[model samples]
Target: MINASGVLRTPRQTLFWRVTNCAGAQDSARIFRVEKYFSPYTPIKSRKSMNKGEFVESLADRLDVSRAQADRALSAVLDIVAEQLAKGEKIAFTGFGSFEVSKRAARTGRNPQTGATIEIAASSVPKFTAGATLKAAVNGK
Candidate 1:
């Protein structure tokens, strides 16, 4: 990408090759850049985030079950949690987390663009509180 207006941008480990342009002129020299990837097994990915598919696969491996079974188990657990929260009930898994509904109060908010006053309605939102064991595990204790 061209950047900084006056300066040119080049990525790390970028390979530059010169080729002859045939369409515009006879054997006109043109430069091109090729990007190189360090990983040979898989493309670059973030380890911070795990998608549903990966989670299901991991669950299946750990539980010694099929992917479909693991996915169904996960879906059922999520459905139960959501159902409990919707019913105004708190579901607490000891040493893991607690799921509950949070009540938000109605308040007046100002519109940033027009500087106008707006009435914001109150709502119930789902909240999760991590338990001691979960927090400790995250902290690498």
Candidate 2:
């Protein structure tokens, strides 16, 4: 990277290295034409979110199994987790995470539109706590 003529410049470079030519004189500092390539169309991957279908596809590809089989397996796993959670049972996957039901106490909330107080009923919601391995994986370990 070089700044010249009040312009921020990036030398033409590949992912790992850049190309620069030193003039005939070895003593001279290399004068490299700094040209940055910025493509507006280059896709910026903000996040890799896997939907249910994409997840099934990934599972199928990884397991070398049919899509239907993968889908069924995913469905079964989800169903079992839901069943266990509904029964107030916690499911823990060693080093992965734990899934359980969290209960929210009933409360009163103000309605924004009417400025009126409303009663919010208590409810149970599914919750997941990431385990050590899962946290490590997310942190790029």
Candidate 3:
């Protein structure tokens, strides 16, 4: 609800947080309300996915390197992984994970739209199995 001062008010909290410089507005501090409960639409904190650019920027900042260098390093790592996987070789980083190519056999499958049978051709795809350290890190251990 909008209060008399044009600030959003939430029924659960009598005191609201004041935020300035919102959306380039030059008015006084405004209050933005937050939900008291979580809904399905609310974002999950544990599984937020970072985009490639953001990841690269963060890596650069952490390593004290330029973004260009970080980008090149990231690309080289990905290229090497792709090359190894293409050769049916596995790439392993002891505490991180391993990446390899796996084969899928051709099989008959059903078409969901028309309820018809379909054939799935055999192919090879890259797969990654996380190592113990990575698993522990993800689980907040």
Q: Could you say which candidate leads in TM-score?
A: 3
Whichever of 1 and 3 has more lDDT, that candidate is: 3
Q: Which stretches of candidate 1 lie over 4 Å from their true place?
A: 1-46
Q: Per-residue lDDT tens digits of candidate 2, residues 2-37?
A: 343333333332222234565563646656643443
Segments of candidate 3 deviating more than 4 angstroms: 1-47
Which candidate model has the greater lDDT, 2 or 3?
3
Model 1 vs. true fold: TM: 0.66
User: Which residue pairs collide, candidate 2?
Assistant: none
The positional error of residue 56 in candidate 3, measured at the CA in angstroms, is: 0.7
Pick by TM-score: 1 or 2, better one = 2
Which candidate has the top score in lDDT?
3
Any residue pairs clashing in model 1, and if so which? none
* Candidate 3: pairs in clash: none
**How do the candidates rank by lDDT, highest first?**
3, 2, 1
lDDT of candidate 1 vs native? Answer: 0.77
- Over 7-104, each residue of candidate 3 has an lDDT whose tens digit, in order, gives 54333233333434456554665644444322344334544577899889999989999999999999999999899899999999998999999999
lDDT of 1 by residue, 1-141 (tens): 534332332432222333334556544455433343333333333345779998999999899999999999999999999889999999999999999999999999999999999999999999999999999998889
